[model samples]
Target: MRTTKLPTIELSLVTLRSIQKKDFKDFFEFGKDKETTEFLTWGPFKTLKDAKTMLKYIYFKRQQRNEPIGYAIVSKETSKMIGTIEYHTFNHKGNSCEIGYVLHKDYWKKGIMTEALQKVTQIGFEVLDLDKLVIKHLRENIGSKKVILKNGYKLVAIYEKQHFHTKTGQYHDVFVYEHWKK
Candidate 1:
């Protein structure tokens, strides 16, 4: 697999940078909210310890393993980490990988994620020189669906009850979308 070193990505509203130890407090800001994590697979952190442990893994362990890492989405306006966007579950042999993101509930409905994804898409296709990108979202996550569409991903497949959403305590169908290098 190709190892990655994340760069600081500056967008109009947010900056995508590496996770740092001190950013735990910013993550805790919205991470403690159940509603914010309602559609995701992890987090609604109850304590700083939880945030700390997760940050440690993102900051340290993934690098050691040469896993495909991601950027922490920090707001330029507030200078705080409000969410993250990353390439995960890499399939190097196929030259494709999945993209995922989460934003603080307070910043939802704005065009922040859409802008961030556009740049990431450029990096994925040009910097990384990958053939395509993949993304998935739960069937009920209309917000996520919108972001995926806005970023120019097209519906490629659907699976019945693909992911068991621990946040919502139920199985949910998943929509798989792909955007090839253009």
Candidate 2:
């Protein structure tokens, strides 16, 4: 049975913690940024209500299932939610999971995501004992490609016309990366 629980991971520049209702304001701050959600499956949250609804779904519903271990990425200095990351699409029988993340555009290229991802990948392998972890991004998202590579993930596959961009309303190729426990 799956027994791993998402824990509050503290790092030098960021902390990955469970989402809170009180984070509504900060959540909306970045969730509404077009540039930040450009490559993400979900947002560009149109209203505060939308953000609240999403938080509820993320914190309550997803948690109850013990899947999609979600985290709110907070800046240590500002104590504000700057992004989110998660280990989702779990397959217990296969001991595998997919990693997903998004950061505020302002924090891009700062190595913040690299640090957060390294911590979460360690958690997936050492704590959860997962055998394989996968990460995928649009073929055009170079930033995501860098982050995946920096974490020692290898390009395992590419699916053509596999991902649909909500905003652009166009299908794009996706690159899948994976890391196996050594």
Candidate 3:
């Protein structure tokens, strides 16, 4: 495997880096939008400063892992961060990882995530040598489930009432999907 610098694994999106501190404001704005945050595990940011604090935490994790923690899905035309996709729970020896993604509601249905996941999954398999990738989505989130299926991930499991509604404080069923590169 070619273990190169961050730039080597960075996805192309017009003119932006994979993830940057300067992108915090845009990330905050997108994440705070109700439509965008509805399916996310995190928040409706009360403030940008809160978002910055979260960004700091994200950077800390990246430093510790010495890996590309995540990528800010960006737009080439406007050079803005539109969303993000990441792998967090990695089992190195198993060659497996859990994936997560979210985009600004405005960017949904544009196939932005499909393209980004294709590139990222290629990297996870070809470059990182991961054999399997798993993605999960709330069962009610039809759009997210579609994204996973469209990306070639296969339905593997369904967690009964396993998703915690970030807004409603209710538990819901979630569908777990997996893809292997073999």
What lDDT, from 0 to 1, does candidate 2 have? 0.87
Query: Model 1, range 58-131, lDDT digits (tens) per residue?
Result: 64576775764578898888898999888777687898888888899899988988998998888888777788
Superposition error at 114 for model 3 (Å): 1.1
127-165: candidate 3 lDDT, tens digit per residue: 767789989888888988877888899998898988778
Question: Tens-digit lDDT track for model 2 on 79-180?
Answer: 999998888888878899899999999999889999999998988888778999999999989999999999999998999999888788899999999999
Each model's lDDT? 0.83, 0.87, 0.76
TM-score of the candidate numbered 3? Answer: 0.89
lDDT of 3 at 102: 82
**TM-scores for every candidate against the unseen true structure:** 0.92, 0.93, 0.89
Question: Which portions of model 1 miss their true places by more than 4 Å?
Answer: 1-3
